[model samples]
Target: MEKEFNGRDLKLGQIQDGNSDYTRYHITYKSGDLTISGIMNIPKGIPPEDGWPVLFLNHGHIDTSVYTNGRGLRREQDYLARQGFAVLHSDYRNHTQSDKDPNTETDVRLGYVEDVINAVMAVKNSDISSLSKERFGMLGHSMGGGISQAVMVVRPDLVDAIVLYAPVSSDVVDSYNRWTLRNSSNAEKIRSAHGSPEENPEFWKNMSPRTFFDRVKTPIIIFHGTADESCDIEWSRETRELLLAAGKRVELVEYPGQYHEFGATFDDFMKRSSDFFKNNLK
Candidate 1:
């Protein structure tokens, strides 16, 4: 049975001042029955006349065994916060301090997408008068990029712009097939619990961003490394093509030989993302 979502308010709480130009808070927001936890980075100086714009940060997949509270994109979050944007990074359910779920293949890990969307809603409706409820953007890496695409399809007005880094394919079925190639037994279990991709195409279709490209209205900038092994660079290229064909605003920035994590090119990636948000969100 699908759980009921009420889009409840966030119980904002400040954990620390960050001891820098940005203040850090530990946020707890209601996402269904479970309360999710994340770090919110707020600029310490005076707020703009219209309040500070928000940037939702979504991270890539990390092994649960070694994942920490701010695993995938902590550095990127810090950089964004320093750039004068309020950044929120969720731990996501079953990863760190958040709740758990019985996720399956056809579902395509939309739970993480829900967690991110709920977090955005929480910030928009929170009592923090200094944060802008109107202006919002997104930065997603790897699997998080896929989540951002899905979110854009469902909530076109939620974010004004998005930045992606080496994202997975918009096709959830293809992503699941990649997973199955590495772990056949686990893939079979997920398929048995849900239905195989061939038998339950609709389920996969509903979970994929590719199925609803026409609904994506926000402008997006994609950064992909040609040498990336985890997520194929071709996926982002194809997604860019689809979005363009649908008449949506899209741009793809390529890195010649960088890997999935971007390693030495991390700083360049950050600058491009920061610039994109600055230009679009304003």
Candidate 2:
């Protein structure tokens, strides 16, 4: 069973300096009685008239054994903050200090999606002086990109725009098969516990963001590498094609021969991302 999350009654504390221009805070919120912890970056200066526009950042999966808070995409967070935007990145359930959600294979990443949505609600109703309630955006990388797509379908009004980095496939069955083939041992364990995607096609279908693209109205931009070995570049291309076919506002940026993280083109990617958010949110 899934836990119901209330976006109201959010609590934030344990503030620390992210940098000279931004402060990071410890976020404590409810995803149906499970306590989740995350980091929020706020600009030090006075907020704009309505309030400072904020971005809710979603990070891809990391092995929880060594995962720590703010582990994913700190560079991007810092850049976004320095560029005068407030950023919030959730550790997600079971990662870092956040409490764990029940594990399931069929649902796969939906619980993480719920955690991100809960973070969105928490930020929307939060009392942070520097965060604007009306203007909001999202950025996700890899698995996080997949989460972002799912979130857009579930809560289209939560964010004004979204940017994806080397996202995984929206087809849950494909993702499962690919993952299983890559790590057979872990795959067997997972399958034994939750059943294989082949045994549960309907569940996989229900869990896919592609199934709900019609509900997604948020404008989107995606960046992927042609030489990526982790997640096939085709996943992103297929996603972009699907969104276009659905008549949704979307764009895809491809970097030739770049790896999954865009190590060589991080600067260019950040510049385009910053510009996209600035144009859409500000």
Candidate 3:
């Protein structure tokens, strides 16, 4: 998993105009044999000597069929870019214009992790004069946060810092109970093929990021709202506890009355997020 994913052959499509602080463009980067589509935002000013420090933005779970390029993290894309960071928001495989992944449903979507790792490599290998080459920061929301967790464990040095906003559990067993088998009809298909979490602890552990938290070198800060109904705040609490037990650098900030998506507290949240990346990423 670490030897490859050197992102290559980046292609930027037509420019998107509207924002005043940064320039937006549609883009594609190689992820294995697949061509992943995404959106990028470059701040509309001169980059620092080492180029703009980057942020790999990962979005929450949206129905893939209806998802568009940079759909879920538009606010972050713009907000982070305007604050002088190059933002790469991947749509992941089989979403938006990315190539289809035939094994997505059966597999645990580890391919999404590949896409992000490759995205980091793409920026590192690109000829863009304004992209950073040092350790980058990543921000993931909800299911995307789960993917970022895998990214951290799979390649600890790939990203130096991570911000998880109302993330899902790092444990696959918890995830399976909360999402996969909760109200979905795919339980039989999953159990028939790979057995249930209770029936197959090893399989679930192999699929979990918590199993590899001891390998994580990235500094992480998590933000969760008390009233987030879609994803319980307890998830982040448990995740932080596990990370702390592993002796990892981590912090968890709980908003007293916020929800799944930050509303009244978004500005303050972004401010802290901005500071976290600035203080951690090199």
Candidate 4:
């Protein structure tokens, strides 16, 4: 938690074909020693007085072997950019062409949280005149939701608002046991490195965002489907309950019969998310 992140040498390159409302660019920034890749979408119109509000887009877990640059969160990026927010979608280290982090899996994805924090710092340290310094929001889906939670607790000053779409448990151990333990040998790998959650309660608690909810500054809104098979709706319910108990501003919007990927309800959630960023980021 005390580590310093120098999000320096941010370079925006290669303007790509974009929708009518925005322009897209490939971007790279320094997260520690590794060069991280991402995409930035800037709205086509003029900027506000304080400049355009920034949204850091955190995507769900993808197999790193198959992941490419700017591979995830395409719809959210387009909708948010079209809504006049400057969106930055980072492909966390060890994914795509970005440099690898050897400790990523064994350390339980904390490196991802660090990369995200650095992405925010990169914006702050950049010479991008169109981006806002104050009004920074975050949108995370599934595994991305978990990363955003850690980011909130670790760097409370960075985000103005947060939208968690079908997030995993704030407790990383739950996610580990649910996915890792049931599916593969990774459970033993992680346990051998950090010890099991039961065996090393202090270590696990220190890493889980649930342990540090009091440090969160952003107003959190979680959207979950009642029938989400990938990520149980109960996870979001527990998150909202914990946040409320911590005296933080939080709300959970449940969608009945909606799945994890939000098929019919995608536009609805996007509209609600636009409203949230508008009210908070403005």
Candidate 5:
């Protein structure tokens, strides 16, 4: 019999007998006296002499834990572990179970990158025998994709390969405006304008992935839905173009007629993503 896990098809009940133990940890990081909370998932597998390839996964924009618990135990981290990779997933500051600092609103702009860096450090320094600091990969979605780009620039030594899904593009000003118009009502738009791009040009520029493309040397795989309304497909195309122009290794896969979440075909997305990571991370 066959079973499905995290939207991926796999053999059912194929239990490998061994000392396999998985643990969830609460990690704290300090950013100038501000502490943030994050979750770490360590899988049970043969202890590699050096270290197993680690994948640091960043979730999309959400205040709850649902984004991290996609398909329950078949979550991204768990799925990666089943594939013999150690995975680390974290909640950004002021989101989910993480610490809520009073200055979060002001510091949120840099929260994603900070959280990921802290997560990587936590895994690298942890006592997990199967985790090595030398072999690491990044997997991010939506807002996390933007964060991944920033991570590649800030911590290039910590990441080996990257996989971005529905990433935000360099045309942030226009994209944000379009998002506001399509998703928010006039009243909501008026309220959002308080922190609009015009007012936060620096933040937009600093966080835009396109600004640091030349600094990214890690190979990348991008997945985008052609029919995505939330984040335009042009972002992925532009990113691909930039990476290719720089003589970097980048692969892009487009899902035709797919919407924001890519509908119920998420299984297909994970399969392709897993293959991409496997091929690139090795």
Candidate 6:
């Protein structure tokens, strides 16, 4: 069962000050038996003659569109809207107000990527007047970043470019292994049901962006905090190195002493993110 929030009156200004050209709406995209819910932020005040760029924004693990909405990232979305960009930030199946599919919800990670693809397709095919699919990009944070990478490998045509914040590195198995060891109880339970890194090596390998770097041709910009404790800075560094080695277009930005969710700050994270979109989405 899915509970929906239209957020019809959800003020973008609640997150930050920006032009009033953006309006937020909730959408449901079909994925097999599942109905995935998402938030679409469309830039207003533009004539139908002008075409705007589109960006698919994905939230991190254990997070939702509500968090992004409250944390002022929606303001960043509004800022992009003011700049003539349409942003769709979505909640993966089983998270937040999204519906859960019994078949995929049990494996949350894969469901996240599927929901991302669904969101992108929904935005691309939506009847909404404010969105344009020809100019498309993807922006994601943490686990969402990892999903963005996976999406690039499978559906690069849906996106022209990507911007990742504190993205999880390509070595997903190792990362999960370390995480499992540190947080034994919960990790073990998930592993027991979903299979451990060792048991499901193929799944981990397929999901890893590092392993599929050769398949990625789209330009990518990745940001990470060197002091990040959750996902670690080494992951970003390794990804950067792999992408560079593959002769792919990649830009890596590292912030010193910043931890996970460094972008929660209104000025620092929101401003930098908006700037990145402005520069690359052009």
> Could you give candidate 3's per-residue lDDT for residues 1-282 as a string of tens digits?
445777887777878754778889899999989999998988877789989998999999899878978899788888888888889899999998999998775677778988999999988888887888885999999999999999999999988899999998898777778778764556767777778988987888988899989999999999999999888899899999999999999999999899999999999889999989988876
lDDT tens string, model 1, 16-83? 55856788887778776777777788888898987888999998888877887766788898898999
Model 4: what TM-score?
0.97
Per-model TM against the reference? 0.93, 0.91, 0.95, 0.97, 0.76, 0.80
Model 3 TM-score, all chains together: 0.95
| Residue lDDT tens for model 4, 1-282 | 878878877788899768789999999999999999999999988899778999999999899988887888898999999898999999999998688998888888788888899999999898888888778999999999999999899988788999999999998878977887875677888889888888998898898899999999899999999999999899899999999999999989999999998989999999999999899875
Q: Give the range where candidate 3 is weakest over 10 consecutive residues by summed lDDT.
A: 181-190
The C-alpha local distance difference test score for the whole of candidate 4 amounts to 0.90
Higher lDDT: candidate 2 or 4? Answer: 4
Candidate 4 ranges beyond 4 A from true positions:
182-184
> Per-prediction RMSD in angstroms?
2.2, 2.3, 1.5, 1.2, 8.9, 5.8
The ten-residue window of minimal lDDT in model 4 covers 180-189
Instruction: Name the candidate that leads on TM-score.
Output: 4
Model 1 is weakest, by summed lDDT over 10 consecutive residues, at 1-10
Expressed as tens digits, the lDDT of each residue in 10-84 for candidate 2 is: 566788566678888877777656678888788888889877788988887788898888789988998898888
Error of 5 at 2 (Å): 49
lDDT per residue as tens, model 5, 1-282? 011111111011223222355655544544333454555555665657777777878777774545442212235666677776766666666665456655433443465577677667665555556677667888888778877877876666667889888887755555556653555554254435446557767766655666667777888888899999878898789889988887788988899988766566677877777777777765
* Candidate 1 segments whose C-alpha is farther than 4 A from its true place: 1-5, 14-17, 104-106
Q: List the residue pairs that clash in candidate 2.
A: none
Model 6 lDDT per residue over 176-282, tens place: 76654676765766677767767887766765767778888688888888778888888888888888999999888888878876744435665665666667654
- Model 3's alpha-carbon lDDT is 0.88
Model 5 ranges off by over 4 Å: 1-32, 64-74, 178-203, 263-265
Sort the candidates on TM-score, descending order. 4, 3, 1, 2, 6, 5
Q: Quick one: RMSD of model 6?
A: 5.8
Which should have the higher lDDT, number 2 or number 3?
3
